[model samples]
Target: MSESFQLRVNDVEYPLSVDQGRNLLGVIRTEIGLTGTKEGCDDCECGACMVLIDGQPVNSCSYLAVQAQGREITTVEGLAEGDELDRLQRNLLEVGGVQCGFCTPGMLMSATALLAEHDDPSDDEIRIGLSGNLCRCTGYARIIEAVRRTADGA
Candidate 1:
């Protein structure tokens, strides 16, 4: 049964009707029209569908939409403030962390949560934080550097 629910996404409150087991990924991308979050391994093996649920990274592909009611969610679209890009984004570009870009958004979101918890994450922390996200394009060195740069530069 679909019921009324309010989901605060990217700082905007959206009224929606979602049933249990309705994937948050579809709601965010199709219903809400925020496609920055990619769908990879639907089984949660790939971190491409990552989003921040109340400031913590979660794989939206398997997360139920109804579970997000009354909670804050942040997609890749929320990383920027108008024209100013988040430091992680800037560093990603500057450090060549993005290549094919399929995994960029997830990487950025995961790194955002990591940096939020640890402003200066060590190399191992960056690796562990990004372990869920897989990037076949740029490898991981650049991505790790980008996160490190963003955290250190902050």
Candidate 2:
């Protein structure tokens, strides 16, 4: 059965009635119209649907909309402030981290979480932070460098 639900996403609260177990990925993309969060390997194994819940990276594909409750959620759309992109986003483009573009959002979310915790993340640390996100394109080298450069204050 469907019921009324509410979730705070990107600093905004959305209230709607949806299927009990609808994934956050679908809610964010379909209900809220923020399509940057991609859906790949919907089983939560690919990390393409990664998003931030209270500053932690999570797979939205597996996270139910109802589970979000009153927690803060951050999606790729929240990474920017008006016209300015976040440092991680600028670095991603400058370092050529985005290729196919499908994995960029999830990768950025993961990197954002890592940078939030460690300002000077090592190469291995960056890898570990982004380990959950899989990208078939760009080989991850540029992506790693992008995160590294941002973390190094470059």
Candidate 3:
């Protein structure tokens, strides 16, 4: 039987009825209409479905909807304030970090989590923090540069 749960997504609370084994990615995309969280490998490898769960980055493709109850879930849609973009988002654009844009959301979520903890993370630390999120385009150099730029306030 399906169960009902509340999810705080992108700073909005949504009461949804989901299947017993529904994953957060599917729920977010299909139910809540948030398409930023892409489903890549669905095995927790690609990190394409990354989202912030209580300020921590997680693979939403493998995370159950029930597990997200009462937690603050942040998606790519939440990174900006109206017309203003987040620092990382702006840096990504300026540094050419986005191509194809499938992995951009996940990359942003992971980088956001890292910045939340370490505003001045080193390049190596940024690399390690974003190791799980993969990008087929841009070669990840630009993405890394974007994160570093955000950290450095550039």
Candidate 4:
């Protein structure tokens, strides 16, 4: 049987009925109609399904949708203010951190959480912050640079 619950995502509340076993990623993409979060390994190996839960990064693929009902979830879509991209988003593009773009959302989410906690992070700190995410297209140098630039207010 499915359970009906509310998920506050991207500052919007969405009431949904889904199977109790449904993952947050599926619910966010299918039920809530937000596709910014991607499903990579689906086993929590890749951070492609990463989203912010109460300002912390989480792998939505392994996290149940029902468990996310009471928390604030921030997806990649939430990072932007309408047509204008967030600073990190613009930096990612400006630094050529995005390649195929499959991993960009998760990367952005993780980096967002990192920057929220650490105003200025070192190279090691940035690496540790984005350790969960795996990117195949960009060697992660540009991605790291983008995060560093964001931290440096550049």
lDDT of each: 0.92, 0.93, 0.92, 0.96
Identify the runs in model 2 with alpha carbons over 4 angstroms from their true place: none
lDDT of 1 by residue, 1-154 (tens): 8877888999899888777668999999988889999998888988999999999999999899988888899999999999999898998998888899999999999999999999888999999999999998987999999998888884
In model 1, how large is the Cα lDDT of residue 76?
96
Candidate 4 lDDT, 1-154, residue by residue in tens: 9999999999899989899999999999998899999999999988999999999999999999999989999999999999999999999999999999999999999999999999999999999999999999988999999999999997
Alpha-carbon RMSD to native, per candidate: 1.0, 0.8, 0.8, 0.5
For candidate 1, the per-residue lDDT at 20 reads 69
- Considering every candidate listed, which one attains the maximal TM-score? 4
Candidate 1's C-alpha runs over 4 A off are none
> How high is the lDDT of residue 66 in model 2?
87
Clashes of each: 0, 0, 0, 0
Residue 154 local lDDT, model 1 = 47
Residue-wise C-alpha lDDT for candidate 3, range 48-90, written one tens digit per residue: 9999999999999988998899999999999999999989999
Name the best candidate (by lDDT): 4
Candidate 4 local lDDT, residue 80: 91
**What digit string (tens of lDDT, one per residue) describes model 2 on residues 42-153?**
9989899999999999999998898888899999999999999989999999988898899999999999999999999899999999999999999999999999899888
Q: Candidate 4, 99: how far from true, in Å?
A: 0.5
Ten contiguous residues with the weakest lDDT in model 4: 10-19
- By the TM-score metric, which is better: model 2 or model 4? 4
TM of each candidate vs. truth: 0.96, 0.97, 0.97, 0.99
